[model samples]
Structure formats: structure tokens, C-alpha cells
Target: MIADFDVSSDWHVAAPYGFLRGLRHEQPVFHSPHLGAYVLTRHEDVRAAYGDAKRFSSAGSLTISRSLTQATRDRLGEHGSFLSSFVANVDPPDHTRLRRSVSRAFTPRAVAAMEERFRRLNEDVLDRVEPDGRADFVPGLGHIPSTKLTARFIGVPESDEEFVKSHVKDWFMLFLSPQPADRQLELADSFLEYLAYVDRLVAARAAAPQDDFTSLMTSLIGSELTHREVVELISTILLGGNDTVPNQLGNSVYRLLRENIWPVPADLTQNAVEECMRIDGASLGSFRYAITDIDLHGVTIPAGALCLLSTDSAAHDETVFDDPETFRIDRPNADAHMTLGYGIHFCVGAALARLQLRTALDVLGERLPGLRLAPGQPIAYRKSIVGRGLPALLVEWD
Candidate 1:
């Protein structure tokens, strides 16, 4: 079965566990002809790669240079250079300063201050769904608070939420998702428009300071970061913060309901969330480029080789978590999941994510304890390589 694995196949992208497990067991570090990169499947190897940023550069982690065809590159023109500036893709020294500057907004103290706001936003959204006995959780419950909170956090006007959301996915696809060069060119057009919009937003925030994230970046423009850097960081946040949380929302809730574990105990809400992250996290894994010819597990990855660290597969590695496939809310090492990443690259917005997710579960369970997956509706995940997300989750509460 391992010999039959195909990374680019629609079946694998939509549901990768079978293939990933095969890779981890049969070949922990296996090269995929389709991906033109090595795949690290074991927990130990994947975690080590994330920590060894020096050896594995983050640049080209999302969008490999070879993926950009000549036509696509020509279309991107000067704006093409900004792709490397995304906070997640930059290496070491540059990443350090950028992360520090933005860290103020996501500190535990700052995130704690946001709990009350998060709770209210979650409540407002759930309140609408309570009247109906059944609903699709994706747009109705999952995306509502996430979009609203992220917009408000970043100083994007609520009126423009739909506009921002519309373009964020296309931007994600342009970099993370594999598509034909012609399609990438089309995506680049929308990406440039969105980039320009963020540039305007950054300028506006600089001109009239506000009590939000954009203004905070603007305040540090000349000293710690450049105007263009601020724009890139904001664009990164918008892209990063937008999809993952919404996907996590659907994934967490979907697991609980499917496993018949609803009405999670108040004391175990955090544990429940962590277990979800371990087993059914939103993101599959991130990409990195090996800086030197390296050997691991009887395989040698050439210098400059691309590696897809399978954090999802790592989470399910039997060596890391005993009986890893089972969904256990009380799992002791659940929080160790690599879904949000590891080491210096760990997600900065983790605090915000936790606050929102915990609030989502608490509010939904308290108000709709009877929640259950609607009968006769099949659950379908998005056809995304990096993100494991449900497009819609039908549920009902009596």
C-alpha cells in the first residue's frame, strides 16, 4: 500500500491519514515524485525539523520558487518579491524582529483581555442559530465570530469583512495550493489587488492611529519595520488568522459530535480542545527547505531539497501518542500536537485561538447541549493540501 501512495491524488489530499500512516511506518522520510520533496512522517523527525530552522530554511516553505512558472512570475512582476516577506516564510534574524513587534497583541495578558470580547462575539453568533433546530455550522457558527474578531483585532472595518474574506482564500491558494500556472496567474491578479488594499489600510492606520493591531504596527513603522514590512505582516495575519480558526471550529465540533462526546465537562473544555488539535487539527503541515544535504532514517535529502513536515501524521504517530488514532479528551500529551507548529515558528495567535475556541465550545454546549450531527448528511472536507477543513457541518439541537 505504501508503494501505491500518491500525494497529489484527490483522495489523499482530502483524507491523508491512511497514506500518512503508511509513510510513517514503512518509510518515515520518503520522497514523493509528485511533490518533488521529501515527506517527514514520524513525530520525532517532524518536530526536529520545525526546531531546526537553521538547517531547514523557512523561505520557500509555502511557495517554492520552481512552482512559479515564467508567466506567473511575469504577472507578479515587482510584487512577487513580497511573497518571501510573509512572517512565516522568513528566516532567523528578520523573523525575530517581526515576531517581537507583533507579539504585543498576542501576549497572554493581552489575549486574556480579549476573553470577554470573544465570549460576547461567540454568544452573538450562537444566539442566531439557537432559534433554528438545525444549521450548517461552517458559515453560521464557525466563521461568524472568527471573521468578526479577526477584523476587529486588525482594525478592518466590519463592513468590509465580506470583501476581506472573499480574497483571503484566493491568496492562500496562490501560495499554498497547487494549481496550473494559468490559474496561478489569475489568482495573482486578485492577490495584487488585496495586497494593494492592505497597503492602503496600513497607510490609513499610520495617518490616524487607532487602538488596533494595524495602528500598533504603524507606530513601529520607521523604527522596527518598514511600511512595506507592516503591510506584509498584516497581509500574513489576515491570511493566517482567517482560515485556520474557522476550520478548527468545524473540526473540533465535528469530532465531539461524531464521537458522541458532547456536553464536554467544564473542567475539561481545554483538554477537549487540545485533543481535537492533536487528532483533527485544521492544518495538515507546513513546508520547509533543507539547507544542506542531510540524511535521516536511511534517506538522504539533497541540499536545497523541499520537505513537507507531516505534523498531522506526527500527531497520529503511535510512538508519540499511545493509541494515537483514538479521540480521547483526557489524553495526557494532547497539547504537544504540532498543528500550530513548534519552536520559534509556533503560532503567535495561539492565545487568541484558544480563547475563541474555548468560548465557542462553552457557549455552544451550554446553550445547545443537545447538539448532534444532522442525520443523513455526509461530511465533506475541502480539497486542500495544507488545510484539513470541512466546507459544511450539518448539525441539529433539539
Candidate 2:
């Protein structure tokens, strides 16, 4: 069974549940040549690996796909090794310290305070499309609000929005995918440019602080972090919210309408969002490196082995979720899905993401209860192993 499963095939990358379901039952810890990692499909195994930081280190989790060529390294110059201080790619001690420095921005009070503004943003975007009675929800409804709010939160100037938008995907591709040396070099140039822009923003904030995320980090530069660390930290936060929210919004809205669960009651909007996350989440899974030999179900993952913890597969495990294939907005255990993450490295922006999802649902449900997918439009998804998302969702309402 393991011999037949090709993790990189277009079929599997576009929709992998069928193959993953078989892997969960036959070989839960099968190693994949494409990913060069032992894939864990069971919910229990993935969750345990996530919580055990000592056994499964997070270092190099994102960039382990391939090594950089010396030419690419030279192109990067000082920016060649930027992930050293990224919160998601480091273990505790450094991870704890770095996470603590930005923890205040995500506190409940702070996140709650953004709801009023978040709602207005969603309403404004939806209002523009309501008169059309049809629109590509991905960009028209999803991307606009998410990008605007994230940029403002991170202190990106309106004048630089196009620059940031055009290049952030390069950062995503460079770190998240395995590419050829030449492609890597191209991405390296884009990344270095982005780093320089961030460095400029940091220096400006240091000289004249503002009420934004960059200013917050600049204040702690000498006290809690170094200049380079602050630059990498802000870059991580900027990229963190960049596509994840739009991807999730696209996923959630697609599920709600396709499954006829729209107009989710005001009280159950959160439950509906969790159900969408469980059934069709944007985050497929993430990588973790093994620190020591560990045996699971008669398979041994050797020391320093890379592991792909399949949260998407775990969310569909029959043992954990009854009638796993069914999309039920009222499923009692929908919140148990590991889409956001688990344990210490759980998503720091979970609250803000939820706020955006809930607000979108409320605004759409109130205004477009008749919403439905536009007929004759083939459903398509971006071919990404880590983040599952629809690039465009053509929607219509009476």
C-alpha cells in the first residue's frame, strides 16, 4: 500500500482523503519518498508528536525540503539563514522567549477589541458585491478584508500593499516547497528584498514608534530581542496572517454553501466554523523533525528523521469522529480538530482568524441567505500540500 501512495501526485495533492484514509488503516507511519518524511495519519499519533517537543523538534520544519546551492546562498548573502529566529521553526527556550514577546498583541482583550473593526471590514467588502448578485468569493469577499486588516495590523503602509502582496507568495513558496536550485535562487532574491523592506520598517519604528505590530516589536528590540531577531519575527507574523485567513475563509464559505448549512444561526456561527475547519480545513499539516528513534505501530523513525504530521487526515479519523465523511455543523466534537494546531506551538493568531471567519459568516448570512455556487463553474483548488484552498469560488444569490 505504501508503494502505491504517491504524495505528490496531482490527484493526491488536490484531494487526498481517499488515499490518507487507507494509510490510516493499513500503514499509519509509512515513509514517503516525495516528502522524504514518515507520514503520521492517525489522530492520536499526530497529536502526541505535536505535544512532545523533546522527541519531535521543530527546527528546520519548514525549510527541510532542500538545501540551498552556494550560488543561491551567495545571492541571499546575509539573508541566507533567516529562519533561525522564526517562532514556528525553533524549540522552547528560544521559542518560549520569542512567543512571549508578542503574546500581548494576541491577548483576548486585544483580539476582542478588533471585532468591531473586523465586522465593519467584512460588511464593507460584502456590500460591494451584493449588488452584482455574483462574484468570485475568494478575492472579492475573502482576500480583500483579510489582506487589508493584516497589513494594517503589521504596520505595512498602504503605498506598499502591492509590493507586499506580490512578494509574500515568494516567501511562502521558498520556505514551504521543494524547488529546483534556479527557482530557489529566484525566490532568494525576492526574500532578500522583503527582508530589506522589513529592516527599513523596523528602523523607522525604532526612531518613531507607532501603534502597530512593528512598533511593538521595535520597543522590545534591545530589551528582549536583537535587531535581526526582530526583523525575522515581524516577517514571520506578516506572512503568518497573509494567506492563512483568506485560505480558511475560502474553505469555510465553500463548505457552508455547498453543504447547505448557510445562514448558520447567530449563536452557532462559531460551531459552524469549527465544523468547516474539521471537514475541510485550509492547513493540511506541518513537518516536525525527530530527535531520537521512536517506534509506533511496529515502525521505527530513526533519529533526525523528518515527519509529516497529517492533521487533515487526523481530522477524518473514524475512531475520533463519528460518520467522519459527513459534514455536520452541529457535531459535538468539531472543536477537537487539530487544524489550527496543538500544544505549545499552537497558532498564536487563532483568535484573530476566528474573528475574521465568524464576522464573514454573520455578514454573509444576514445579507445573502440565498447564496449558492454559480452553476457550470468547475471547482478548483490551489495545488499546495500544506495549505488547501480554493483560488476562486464563483458564488451567486437571488
What are the lDDT figures for the candidates, one per model?
0.85, 0.85
lDDT of 1 by residue, 1-398 (tens): 46543545567755677778888888888988777778898999999999999889898586662366778879888877666776788898989998899897787887888888878988898777789898899988888888888888899998888888888878777776667978888888988889888988988987899999999999998899888888888887887668898899899999999899888899999999999998988988888999998889888999999898988899998888999889998999999899999989899988788888898899889989999999999767777657788889998999
Candidate 1: count of backbone clashes, pairs at least 3 residues apart or interchain? 0
Model 1 regions lying over 4 Å from their true place? 4-10, 65-69, 180-185
Q: For model 2, how does the per-residue alpha-carbon lDDT over 1-398 read when each residue is reduced to its tens digit?
A: 44544545667656677888999999999898777899999999999999999999998787676467888878877776678668888999988988898886788988888888878888888778889999998878888777878888889998997788767878778766667889998898898888889989998998999999899989998898788888887787777667888898888888888788878889899998898888888898889999999999999999999999999999999999999989988899999999999988899999898888998889889989999989888877777678788889999998
Clash pairs, candidate 1, are: none
Q: Highest lDDT, which number?
A: 2
Clashes of 2: 0
Worst 10 residues of 2 by lDDT: 1-10
